[model samples]
Target chain A: MGFLFEQDNFALFRDGFLQTIELSALSALLALLLGTLLAAFRVSPVPVLRAFGTAWVTLFRNTPLTLLFFAVTFGLPPLGVHFSHLVFAVLALGGYTASFVCEVIRSGINTVPLGQAEAARSLGMTFGQTLTLVVLPQAARTVLAPMSSVFIALPRNSAIAGAFSVGELYSAQQTFSERGYSIFAIFFWVACAYLLISATVATFFRFLESRLAVVR
Target chain B: MSILNRPASAGVLYDAPGPKARARYRLFGVLSVLGILGLLWYVFAALDANGQFDPDLWDPFQYNFVQQMILDGLLATLKAFGLAAAFSLTLGALLAAGQLSDHKPVRWACTGIVQFFRAMPLLILIVALYYAFFAKQSMWALVIGLTLYNGAVQAEIIRSGVNAVPRGQGEAAYAIGMRKTQVMASILVPQAVRSMLPSMIGQLVVTLKDTSLGLIITYQELLFVGKKIASQPMNAAGFPYIPVVLVIGPIYIAMCLLLTALARWIEARGRRGANRRTSPAA
Candidate 1:
């Protein structure tokens, strides 16, 4: 525990914590954007686009995050693609998480009453207009809780990036362990950091949920 | 669910297209197909330029020793998954029981354990356990870590399943002079198991995927073996990283898909059996 207060060790820990936060934040944004696109594709009238979306979801959802990490880290360079470790980590985590986010959004869209879309259509609105203006707004409320879970999972999944040389909290755990610090103390602080992230995300979602909440 | 099988709610998003709309859709479809094909071709060209499609890079997988190593790794992955699945299910059951206990302290303690473990990143837990206790036994470290995290998840599922059982069912048991333990064992659990089976199996798929994490600690599971194979450079084709991913990635995907299919199958059967029981009674 005393080692936690040491200037150098504390710096390492803070950097790792910040790295984890950056990874989670960047990937969360990517996931939301890509996932929303995938969800739209899934529900659109275009068969090819729908097929493409389904394939993306199935492939990402079924594959292990570690395998995805390895593919990004080792496999992509062979194919003439290159990026920094952090970028690769973000791409992999965001791509993988997008599948889950797509599912949650699609389910949320399902919860929107059929009459809402029907009313929009009867008023001469186009499919795009009905979806963007009518369906998605209603879906957003229901999507909040599940979306939070997905975002909360982002930080946890970011831990895997540490192994792929992304310098996150889990990597910090390894460094601390190697430096001969008490394993329990190191894990304790690390766990607290993760808990704090989870709690913060959960609270943010709860706040959003309340603001958008509609009385049945 | 497969995307081809559209859900009932899908019809809400759009009505049947009129002639003009249908023509527009056809045009859009063709453009999208062309776009996808162009993307695929680009990827193929890139891989080809790098000699990733060379037969030499894939040749290592043909050897008997290499095949045996993959088999051993797969078996080890399954072994870890089996142990973790069994232990986690048992732990989940106990914790669920504890959470539902009439004793307030027991319930609070169980809730704390579940919540803490649930929030903990599993990789962190596994690594911590490896360093703190199972330093030499990486397999146990992975197994225990998976057990703790998944057990908490399963406990919530089980508790929810039990609670979802109708109040009248449990009350009837109590009204019939059944003891608390007897009511739970004979009434709540039997019903809850039916509802819990799908999610439990889903968690098992998660556990199987997580066995790959054993590679981080040098557990020599399938992914670890794949990594080992990939790291060794073959003649002129550089490391066989792409080949390894192509081969090993599908195995993980197939296993998870199979588990998911099994869960759906079991759930369907349970629902059918349930209908039969109710219809006969009616």
Candidate 2:
């Protein structure tokens, strides 16, 4: 257990922790952007966009994230499409999570009063304008809490990147646990680190919600 | 994604396209279709060049031995899922009850356990359990690991469901001189079970899929079996990567869809008021 905090081991944990954070942040950001686009497409009048968005969600969301990683890591690289294992992992995570974010955002969009869009329409706002200016802001406000769950989930899911040999916390735990220390101790400490990350994301979003909350 | 039954209010963002807008939409549709086609073509061509489409690579599944292995693997996978789902649900129900307990220590203890398990990653939980706790018996490790992590998730679902029960219902139970346990068992849990049935089933779906994480520790589940099949030297196609994915992928999608279909059936039963008898307190 003491070996966990030894100078060399400590650096491994530090790097792994930072990498986990980076992976989560990058994946969450990408998922948010992709999800928002899919949400917009879902509500669009264009039949094609709506179909594509539906296909994206159905195909990716139902498949396990592990399989997605398997496909990206194994399937693509053999076809002469090479990327860093981390990059493929990020794509896999973002791709799967975006489907969830799309659902959460769509539910939020559905919550916005229909009359608000009607009112925006009467004021000469185009469909795009109504969505971007009136609906999205309201949807964004409503989805912060749900979206926070998605982001919190992102870091935890980042652990799967270890399957691809990505040097994240899970991989670090694997390494340390292999070094003859108690595996439970290694997991306990890494889980504590993850708990801190989850709590921070949850707490920060809570603060943001309070600050941005609007009275009806 | 779009196959979801659209709620009646789904199209709130915009109206139907008018004549000119319809023409523009059709053009956009054509371009999008072409883009998708081109991407698919690129993948097809590249994979062909890489020999991923060799029929010889896929022919191994025709053998009894290969087929039996996959069948056994699927059963093993289901067994893990079944155990995890049962234990996790039981654990979740108990933890939820404790979190809602009248005693502060019990409530706090349950809450702490739930949060700790929820915060931990499933991979680490499974791996740690495999290596540290039950190194000799990998099945117990996987099952218990899944139970702890997913039990935490199910605890939230159960807790929220119980909390969502109407306050007046509990009050009425108490007015009838019902004890805390009785009120919870009869009044709150009954209603909560029906209302939260969908989410509970959703969690089960996740649990079933997550059993594949056993692959990380050589648990010989479906995904791991698929990996075993995929990695075999029976084919000269340099690892039948695409062929393996093509076969194994649909099996998973089918199972997940089956879970979803079951959820829908249960939901519809509730909607039809067919299960009202289950909630005797109501």
Candidate with maximal TM-score = 1
Instruction: Kindly report the TM-score of the first chain in candidate 2.
Output: 0.97
List pairs with backbone clashes in candidate 1.
none
DockQ values, each candidate: 0.76, 0.63
List, residue by residue over A134-177, the lDDT tens digit for candidate 2. Answer: 99999888999888988888899999998777999999988887
Q: Model 2's CAPRI class? A: medium
Model 2: per-residue Cα lDDT over B58-138, one tens digit each: 788899998899899889999999999999999999999889998999999999999999988899888988887787877
Error of 2 at B189 (Å): 1.0
Model 2 scores what on Cα lDDT?
0.86
User: For candidate 2, what is the TM-score?
Assistant: 0.95
Error of 1 at A114 (Å): 1.5
**Local lDDT at B6 for model 2:** 39
- The fnat of each candidate, in order, is 0.80, 0.63
lDDT value, candidate 1, whole model: 0.93
